[model samples]
Target: MPRLMLTDEHWSKLRTILLEDRVYDKPEHRQTMEGILYRMRVGCPWQDLPDTFGLWNTIFRRFLLWTRKGILQRLFKKLISEPDFEWIFIDGSIVKAHQHSAGASSKYDEAIGKSKGGNTSKIHLAVDSYGLPIEFTITGGQPHDSKAAKPLIDMLPYANYIIADKGYDSEAIREQVRGRNSIPNIPRKSNSKVGNDDIDWCLYKYRHLVENTFEKLKKYRAIATRYDKLKANYESMVALACIMCWLPM
Candidate 1:
């Protein structure tokens, strides 16, 4: 079996999530497991993986299986619970995708179109006041930021407040926030002729934390480059990025 380079806590967490009861008797299974840990840490593409990690294709397949089975979500939820946050911030970042990632014609093919740059993928992330990630949603580059607003907001339980930009200033979203018994701290656009931007100025100041969280997430080379060819793998990279954030500095 390949070496486990993650910290003791992370390794233990991975072990619990993986549940050793599941067999890893085959060489491919062991390799793939190591390959995932390697990709998460090194943020490298499968094709660029080193030979000692075993077959890249098998690793990629295992990643897909884990993602489809809600393993990633379970891991993310566990990490999210570790943080104590009174408020959460929401934002999205576009990642430029290489042409190779566009070949897949799956139902979640949101990374195929052009955005701020060329073909790209949008990662909508929600983070708590301390920049700890709470939720993540993926959409095509062309998808509107507001399109993900309600879903991301809906994922959270009741909170003190939720902060977002003017893009999320829809009456529907405001209603959704109120429905959850949380204050919608989103500000209205300056151009909005309907209502005033009534968000508390002080609370809005902390919105930058989520922005910084996106900056940190993009620091990973794999995340900065969209090399995962598949949405699930790419999203796993995001989860790994969040996991790194949750760990002690």
Candidate 2:
């Protein structure tokens, strides 16, 4: 038997969500989900998935339907109905895209862009105090952090602090965070007249929690490197990985 990624407990929780979403009622639901996980864990082409999980084309079709309907990300957002909001961290990570990631039909270039690192995409992510994902946005590799920071800052519930790095040290972001009743704990750039004197070094250090979340999610090679030609599909894979992270909680 091939090794499986989801534990019994993980399947139990996920199955409930899938049922509530009314995606499928077949007995093979567990195998189907496992098939997708297997593809992600091994970072293999969909055609190359092992047979123990059933025909890979069938599983890929199911996954396609889920992404088309936004079920994957909807499930992720559902899991965060309650979270520790003492400190909210927002950051972006660049994921290298395979040459195959290009050539989507979208006029917007499908969130893929050419950066200094060559073809790439960026995941603008926010995590809660405990380093669990809260919400995220996908953008071309070169969009500035502040460009994505507004919606994320506006999404969180009122918290003691919303933290980020110097890259997010714009006045507009600070004002927006304060508008949501949370203090911005970002550090100033080196040349700024308003230095980081008021910054809480203790809390700022914890921004690693967001980086840690990225580290954990990237363990799935499919996530570490972009393979899906469509941005929506790639984002679904990332959402599934985030769900896996929440499963252990």
Candidate 3:
């Protein structure tokens, strides 16, 4: 399938902003930075990054630094102001951590040791029905889906509808979502419901967009196999992946 491409104006704006933040310190820095962005945009591996990207190690290090500083997240927020946002979808997925990415001190709340996947990290992401990601939260594989739902949900305000899975069916969550004037579209758990609640199966089918969003995100090899020793870096890559998904054709 053909991939989406960034426009000249988009490139110019990104180059200007990223360069201001010391992204253009070296002759090869611009190329390296663009290379990594291209790799993220195309879901390619670092080693496989085309020769045009210059030294992969340099690009990777800069990416790590940007990740630590939360640059990618800020960049995504700036870039997504043009998206359609009447409805949002929330969901979570697990990314198996490569052994190399292991040894991160268990001190990291988002760094959970092996459970079902043997050293895997979990990602909770919220996206629009168009599969444009809004926000993400990283945690250990063992963390309950409900654990990060609150924080992830809090990132978005004034959403018309917030859709989630049955796992998020809780009185507290429902009440909290109500505060934003957004109704929860999640089906009530079989054991938890008292009476009939309207659920539109047709609209419910839209939840698959979030699922497909996860599917496309894992296409990045580094993302599919978590290698960032820091949770922030891993999550930054998730944001970069989201940017790729939101790229205009």
Off by over 4 Å in 3: 1-10, 19-27, 37-52, 105-107
Overlapping backbone residue pairs in candidate 3 total 1
| CA displacement after TM-score superposition, residue 191 of candidate 3 (Å) | 2.3
lDDT-best of 1 and 3: 3
* Residue 8 accuracy (lDDT) in model 2: 89
- Could you report the Cα RMSD, in angstroms, for every candidate shown? 3.3, 1.4, 3.5
In candidate 3, what are the lDDT values of residues 165-244, reduced to their tens digit?
88887778888888989877777888764542666667778998889988888887767778777788777888877776
Question: What TM-score quantifies how close candidate 2 is to the native fold?
Answer: 0.95
Give lDDT tens digits, candidate 1, residues 150-221. Answer: 778877766788888887878888888889888888888877786664769888888899889888888767
In lDDT terms, which candidate is top? 2
Per-residue error for 217 in candidate 1, Å, reads 1.4
Error of 1 at 150 (Å): 1.4
Clashes of 1: 1
* Deviating ranges (above 4 Å) for candidate 2: none
Residue 127 of model 3, lDDT score: 85
Clashing pairs in 3: 114-119
